[model samples]
Target chain A: MSVPNAQRQIDMLTKMLRIREFEERVKRTFTDHPGVIRGHTHLADGAEASIVGSLSHFKKGDAALATYRCHGYPIALGTDTKAMMAEILGRVDGLCKGLGGSMHLTDVKKGFLGTSGIVGAGIPHAAGAAWAAQIRKKREVVFCFFGDGASKQGAFAETLNIASLWKLPVIFVMENNGYNVVTTSAQEDANAAAGQPLSIKAKSFAMPGVTVDGTDPLAVAAAVGKAVRRARRGDGPTLVESKVYRLSAHGNIIAPPGVPLHYPEHEAITVFGKREEYEAALRGDPVPRFRGILVQNGTLTAAAADAITQKVVAEMEAAVKFAVASPYPKLESALDHVYA
Target chain B: MAQLPYIAAIDAGIHQEMRRDPSVLYFGQNLATTENHEFVAAYGHDRVRVTPISETAEIGMAIGAAMAGFRPVVELYMAEFMLVAMDQVLNEAPKFRYMSGGQVKVPLVLKAGFGFACGWAGQHTGSLTALFMGVPGLKVVVPSTAADAKGLMATSIRDDNPVVFMHHYLLTLEHGEVPDGEHLVPFGQAAIRRTGGDVTLVATGWMVNRALAAAEALAKEGIQAEVIDPRTVAPLDLDTILKSVAKTGRLVVVDQAPRHATVGGIIAADVVEHGFESLRAPIIQVNARDTTVPYSEPLEAYVIPDEARICAAVRKVCKTAR
Candidate 1:
C-alpha cells in the first residue's frame, strides 16, 4: 500500500517545483507591481521542502494548521492558486473573499484548517482538530507546523502537554527557520546552540520526537511519514522537527527588525538573508538540491523537471492575471461576518 | 418541570444538548470534577473531554474544533482567566466568519464563572459583560435563575456564532425552577423580575436578584422601582430597557462591570439618545468601582455594587420618593 518509489519521487519534485515557481511569481507581483498587496506577507521561501514534504504524507480528510509563512502549503496542496492569488490581491474572488489575505489562505475542503499570524497560536488549534477527529473515531490526523521562535511559547508547552495527555492524532512539525523577527532573546539560537536536538523536548511530553534534514525533501518525507502513520494508528502524536531555512525575509521583501532597510536587497539575490552572518549559515536552498537528487536517482530527467517548471510558470502567469482582473470586495461585506 | 440548583441545571442542559447533537464537544480543565462529569459518563470521554490547565491552548483548540464543524463549549474555571485566551476570542473566533466571507460559522461557547460570591479573590471575580459586548462578533450572556441558566446554556450551545456565557459564581449554589429536557432561552430577551412605576432598574446576572431586593425595599418607601434583567449583552435587549425607562420616566443601570465603557453606561446613553423626552431626571449608573478586585472580603464587598447602592441610586433619581 506504499506509493511506488518513482511516483512518490516525481510527486515530491512536482510539488516543490510548483511551490518555488508560485512563490517566485508572487514575490515579483507583490514587490514589483505597485499596490497589488497591502499589509505583511511572510513567504515560506526555503521551507518549501518541509511544507510540501510534511503535507504529502497526510491523507485526504486530514487537517493542516500552520503559522503565517504558509503560502507554500496550499499551493503545493493543489488549492486553487488563482483564488489564493486573488486573496493576496484582496479580491472578492479570493479564497477568503479578500478578508484573509495571504497570511490566512484556507480551503477547508482540502483539509487546510487555515493559518494564523500569531506565533505558536495554531498549535493548540491542531490539538483541538485532532481531538474532534478522535472523538468522531475518524482516521484523520492533524499536522501542526510551527517555528523555533514559537517553540518557547506557552502555547507550545501547553499544547504539547494536552495533546500527549489526550493522545490526540496530531504530528507537530517544527519549521525552524532560525529567526524570531530579529530578536536574539526570542529566537531559538540559545536552545539550538545548547548542543541538544530541539525535537528532544517531545520526549518530556512522552511522545516521539525526531529532527530531520529539512532541505532534503526525502528526509522530511520519511520523518513526517513515520509520524503520520503513528498518529493514524492511534499511537498519539509525534514531534517531527524539520530544521529548514526561511530563504525569504520575515515578510516577503521587508527585512526583519534591527536589520537596515534595503540591507540585503534580495530583489535579485534569489536568497533571503536574515543577517549577513546568519545568511552564510542558512540551509541550502531545497528546490535545486531536491532536483539534483531526483535526476541522480534517474527518477526524473532534467527535461521533465524543466517541463513541470514551465507548466507552473504558465499557470502562475494566468493566476496573476486572474487576481488582477478580480473585483475589490464591497464595503458592506466587511460587516457581514461579524455574526452568524 | 423541576427545581434544580444552578450547577445541576447547567449540568442537565449540557447533558441534554450533547445527547441531542452528536457534534457538540465539551472541554476544560478539571471538567471531570465539574457538572460536566455526568455528560462524560453518558457520552464517553471523547465527546466530553478533560484537558490540562492550558487556558490559552484550550481556547485555541475550541476555536479550531468549532471551525471544523463541531459545537465546542470551553469552560474556564473563572472569567478573569479569559484574559489568557484574549487573542483567540477577540481576534480569531469573531473574525473567522468575516474573513471567510461568511462561509465559516464558529459555534463556540466560552463558559466561565464570574462575580465575588465565592471569595475566589481578584482572579476569579468580575462579570465581564461589557468587555465581550464591546466586541462586535461575540454574544454575551449572563443568567441569574437556575431556570434561565439551563435555557440560556442550551441556546448558547446551539448558536452558530461565538458566545461568552458567564455564570455568576454566587448564583451557582442557588436553587430555582428549571424545565426538564430541551429548553432554550433565546438571547437578546430581557426578563422583567419586578414591575414598578416611579423608577426603572436595569440589571444583569445576579444583579437582577439584587435589583429585585432593592425594588422590594423601595416599594416600602413608596418609590415603586421596576427591575429589568437583561440576560444577554451583545445582542442586547435595548428595546425592553428603553420601553421600561419610558414607562418609568427614570432609569438606574446596575451591573458588575467597571464604570468605563460599562454596560450600565451603554444603556444610559441609548436611553438618553432615543427616549430623551420620556426622561424625568438624569440617568443613574450603579456599577463596581473602577479598580482591580481586591482579595479581602470587606474590600471585595465594597468593590461590587450592592442592593443598598441600587436603592440609593433609585432614591436619588426619584423626586416623589418618601
Candidate 2:
C-alpha cells in the first residue's frame, strides 16, 4: 500500500487494538471481583475493527444506538475507558451512574442514546432519533448498530420500513458475527432467520443494501462514510451488513466452546483464525501506521501521536479513578431513579 | 359554565394548549385535519399530526421529540394500544431522566381512553391506570369531572415526567362545571368530592361519580360515606387517603380495571400497610370482575365497577365497621 494508505490503515488498527486490549483487561479485572456485576457481560474483545471503522466517521452531534453488548461504540465515541471499566465494576461514577452496569451504557451528552438490553429494541429508538432530526431540520443522522441476531427481531424490520418510508436519515449497521450468545444465527428458530442474506432483507424495504468486509477497517469506514453522506443528502436509510466473526466465545470463555455445545470449538477456531490472520498480516498497528503516514504526508508527527495517546490514556484513567473513588449510590436512590 | 364530559374537557384543554404554545404538538390516529374535528382545525396540520398504524413507533416518536426539547402530546386513542408502546412508555421515557443522570427531561403526555361503554369489546375498554401506576417513573392520571380533566391535563402537559392521562369513554358525554380560567390541580392530592364520617369511598375516573352516587344513597341510610377522588394514580394521594381512613375507620376502593391488578388493590394495600391500626373494619375493593370486559352491555355492566357495586361495597364496609 502507498504511504498514505498504509498510515490510514495503521491509525484504524490502533483504535481497534485499543478496544481489543481494553476488553481483555475488563475481563481480567472482573475475574476475581465476581461481585462487580451480576448477570451477563458480553465483551467485544475480538470484534474491534468493525466498531472502530464504523465509528470513525461519526460526527460530534451524530447519535449511536447499539445492542446490549455495547462497550466498543461508546469507547470509539470518545468516552473514557476507566469510566466504562468502572461501570463494569458497578461503581457510581460509571456512565449510567453504576445503575445500568455492563450490558447498558448510556451517555446522552456524548450522543450515545444508551444501549438496549433487549434484542433489536434500539432499532426503533434510532429511527425515532432520525425522525426527530428530520422534523427539527437538524443535519444530524443516527447510526444503529446491532448483531445479526437482532436483525431477525420484529422491531428491526418495523423500524427499517418506517425509516425508509419517512426518508429518515438513519443507517442500520448489522455486524454479522455468526453467533448470538450460544446459538448461531443459522440455527435460530425464527422464519426471518431462515436462509436469506441480511442485505437481501434490507433490499425488500426498497432501500439500498450492501455487504462489506467487517475485518477490513478501511472498507467499513468507507461504507459508513458513503451511507452517512447519502443520509445527509436526504437519500433515506441504508442497511450495511458488515461480515465479521465472534473471535471469542460469545462472552468470557476466552477459548472456543466444548464439543457438546452447539457452537463447537472447530467452527469457532476457524472463524477466530480468519480474524487473527488479518490482524497479523498488517504491521506496526493501525494507529502507528496511520500516524507514520500522516507524518510523511506532513499532517501529523510521531511526537503528536505520543501526545494524543497520552492525553487520551490520562483522560480515560482519570475517569476510572473517579469512578473507583466515588461513593456507592444510596439504597434509597434506586427508588428515586426508577420512577422519576 | 356548561357541564362537559371528561373526554371533551381533555379535547378542550389540548386545543387550548396548542393555541397557547406553538411548540406544543399532538399526534394520533384520526385526531388530525383529515378528521375535520374543531380541535384539529384550530390546532392545524403543523401541530396536529396524523400517525400511521404503528402505535409503538408513534409513542417512540413522541419520546424522541420530548428528548429533543419538544413538548409532545401523544394520544393512544385506546388504553389497549398502549401495550404496543409499553417499551417506550415504561422503559425509555421513565428511564430517560435517571438513565441519563438527570440530563434529559421527557415532557411527553400520553393520553388514552379506557372502560366499557358501548360494545367496544375486550380490546377497546381496558382501564390500565393500575398497570401504569406500577411503573416507577410515570405519572398516571384518571380524571372524573370536566374541571379536573382540564386542570389535570394542563398540569400533566407542563410536568417534566411522562404522564399517562386516562379518560373513561363513558365520561366523554358526562358533563360537570369546569372553571373557564387557568387552574393547576397538583398531583398527589385527593379531592374529597363528598365528605362524610362513617366510611371512606376511594375512587378514580368514572368511579368517582359512582362512588359519590353510592355515598348519596348511603347518606339516606345514615352511613355518611366520604367520597375521595384520587384523580392521579401514581403520586396517589395516600396522605389524604390515610387521613380519611383514620377518621372513618372503614375503607372501600372502587376501580374500573380488573380485580387482580386494580388501582383498588394498591389503595387497599396502602390502607392495610399504613392505616391498619386506625381501621375499624376490613378494607373492601369494588373492581371489574376477574374476566375480560365482555362486548354485551349486560355482561360489561356486570363485570366493571358500577353504582350498584359501589353501593354494595359501601354497605359491606359500613357493616364491617359496625
Candidate 3:
C-alpha cells in the first residue's frame, strides 16, 4: 500500500533481518558445537518478515501469545536479546529466569505472555488476555501466532468461536509454512479422509479470514495493521494466514541429510538466470535494501545506517558471549518455577 | 457441641463468606439460577453467577480474572466435571505461582461435590478427592459434616493457595446445627467423634458418619472403637490418626473413594510408616470396590463403603489386636 512510509518500511525490514541474523547464528552455534544446549528447538527461519511486520503494528502493553517457534516475536517485542540468548543457553540470567528455556521464553513486562509448546494451548490464553482487556475497558489488542498444525487443534476453533461471539479484540496470525512438522497439508489430507483448506476453518467461526504473502513483510504489515485497527475499534477478532517457506529444518537441529524433500521445500523453487545470476541476487540482502530506503527518505544516512547495524551486531555478539560464558540453571531450580 | 451436617455447613459457609467480602464473586454452570436456584437464593445474583455451561472456558476465565486480581469462587457442578478444566486448574493455576516465581497467589476457591449419591450412575458420581490430593501445591478438603464444611471452607476461601473443596451431593439434604458468628476450623486437624480403648476408625467425607455409626454399634459389644474424622484430606490430620492408633493399638480407615491408591491408601501407608511401633494389630482399610460407582441402587450399595463394612473391619482389627 503506497510502499508504506519509507522510514516505517526501513524499521520493519531491519527488524526482520535482525530476526533472520539472530536465528542464523543460533543455527550455526547449535550445529558447530552440539550439546551446549539441547531440546526441541523450533526457530523462525523462513517466516521472518511475517512476525516483524505484524508485531510492529502494536505498541508496548498490547499483548501477544506466540507458538513454539517464538524466538523472533519476543526479540521484536523488545525482550532483552542477551536474556533471550541466555535462555537458549539455559542460563539463569535468561528470560523466564531460564525456567522456560527456548520454547517458553516470555517477558511479561513487554506484555508477551509465555509461548507454549503444546499446539494451540496458547490460543485460549490470548483470547483470555483480550477478554481481560475488554473487561477492563482498555483499548489493547492481542496477537496470537501459531503454526498450521496448531490451527487444526480444537482449542483454536473453540477459542476463535468464543472470541467472535464475545467480540474480543484478538488477531489470529496463522503462519502456514506449508507444512506441519514433516507432513504437508496434501499428505495430511491423503492420510486423513477430510480434505479442507484450514483458512475456511477460521472463517467458520464468523471471523474475517484471509491469506497473504508472508515473505513480503509489507503485505503482512498492511494486513495486520488493518486487523489491529479493527480490533482497537472493538470490531472483534480477525484470522490472517501468512503463506511462507521454511529455509531450515522444522527444528533448530536438522535431521541427518538425505531426509528426502520433507513437504514441498523444492516445489516453489525461485529459479534464477544462472549460478552467477543467483549469486548476484544474494548480494542484495534486505539490510541494504532497508538502509538505502531510509537514506533516500532522509530519515537516516548511509553512515548512520552502518553504525546502527554495527551496534546491533555488537550487541548480539556480546549476547552470544554472555550465553557461552553463563552457567546452566542448577538442578534444584528445575522444580522452582512449577507454580507462580 | 453437636456436629453439623457437611452439606448444610458448606452452603452456609459460602453464603457467609460472600456476605462478608464484597470482592468475592461466584459463577458456575447452574450456580445462580437453577429451576429452583437454591445456591443463588442463599447468596444473591450479584455475588452468585450462572454461566452458559462452558466448563473449561468458564474455569479458565475465572482463573484469568483471578490473575487480574479478582477473588472468584468457581463452582464445578460436580467433581467429575473438573476433568474438563483440569489443564487450567492443574497446569495454569498451580503452575502460575512457580512460573511467576511466587509472584501470583491464586486465592481462588473451587467447590466440587464428589462421592456416589442417589443412582446417578458412573459419570455423575465419582469421588476424585484423592486424585487431586496427588497434585502438589493444591490443598484439598473433604468435609464430612455441616460444621466441618462451614469451618474448613471458610479457611479454604481465605487461604493463599488454590483449594478444591469436595462435598457429597447426598449429604446436601442431611441437616445439622451450625454455630453462628465467625468460627474458622483449622485445616489438617481431625475431629474425634468417639473415644475408645480398643481400635481407631479413621474416616473422611460421608464415611465419617458410617464409621461413627459402626463405632456406636461396636460399643454395645464392648469393642471400643475410636472414630476420627479427617476434615481435610490433603493436609491430612495424620497426628490425630497416629495418636488414636497409639492408644487403641489398632486402626481401620474408611474412605468413599475407590479401593485403589486413595485416601485410605495414604492413611494406611502413613500410619504403618510412622505409627507402626505403637500399633497392637495390623491396620485395615475399608473402601469402595475397584470400579466405577454403578447406577443401580443395589449395585451402588454393593460398590460404596457402608456401615457394615466399617463394623466388620473394626471387629476384625480388634479381634486380631495383641
Per-residue lDDT tens digits of candidate 2, residues B1-322?
7577767778777766776776677887766646576756776654677667777677776776676566788878788888986787788777767765565677889988887557888888887888889876799988888888898988888888889999888888788887776656888888999888999999888888888888888888888989899889889989999999889999999888878888989889988998899898888888888887799979888887888888887787777674
lDDT of 1 by residue, B132-247 (tens): 88887789988899998999999999999999998888888899989987889999999988888889999888888889999998899988888998888878899998898878
Per-candidate TM-score, first chain only? 0.90, 0.79, 0.83
* Candidate 2 Cα outliers beyond 4 Å, as residue runs: A1-11, A32-34, A189-195, A252-327, B1-3, B20-23, B33-47, B181-183
lDDT of each: 0.82, 0.75, 0.74
Write down the lDDT that model 3 would get: 0.74
- Per-residue lDDT of A1-340 in model 2, one digit per residue for the tens? 1122555555665576557656655555544333444456676754576788888778877888888888888887867777777777677666776777777787777888867777777787787678667766667888889998888776777778778877888999998876777566768834335766667777778898888877767778888778888898888999998877655556543433331212223234455455444345334233444456556866656677667666555664565456556777777666555544
By lDDT, the candidates rank as 1, 2, 3
lDDT by residue for model 3 over B1-322, one digit each (tens)?
4455666677677776777875566877756666457756765554566665566666655555454455677888689888876776676666555554444456678888877568899997887878878776688888777777788788887776778888878777677767787757898888898899899888877788888899889888888888888878877888988888888889998888887857888989999999889888888889889898888899999988888898898888877878
How is the predicted docking of candidate 3 categorized under the CAPRI scheme?
A: acceptable
Q: Per model, how many backbone clashes are there?
A: 0, 9, 12
lDDT of 1 by residue, A246-286 (tens): 67656744644543322233321334333564555343688
Q: Native-vs-model 1 lDDT?
A: 0.82
**TM-score-better candidate, 1 vs 2:** 1
Alpha-carbon error at A265 in model 2, in Å? 7.8
DockQ for the candidate 1 complex? 0.68
Instruction: Identify the runs in model 3 with alpha carbons over 4 angstroms from their true place.
Output: A1-8, A187-197, A252-307, A328-340, B1-25, B31-53, B103-107, B150-161, B178-197
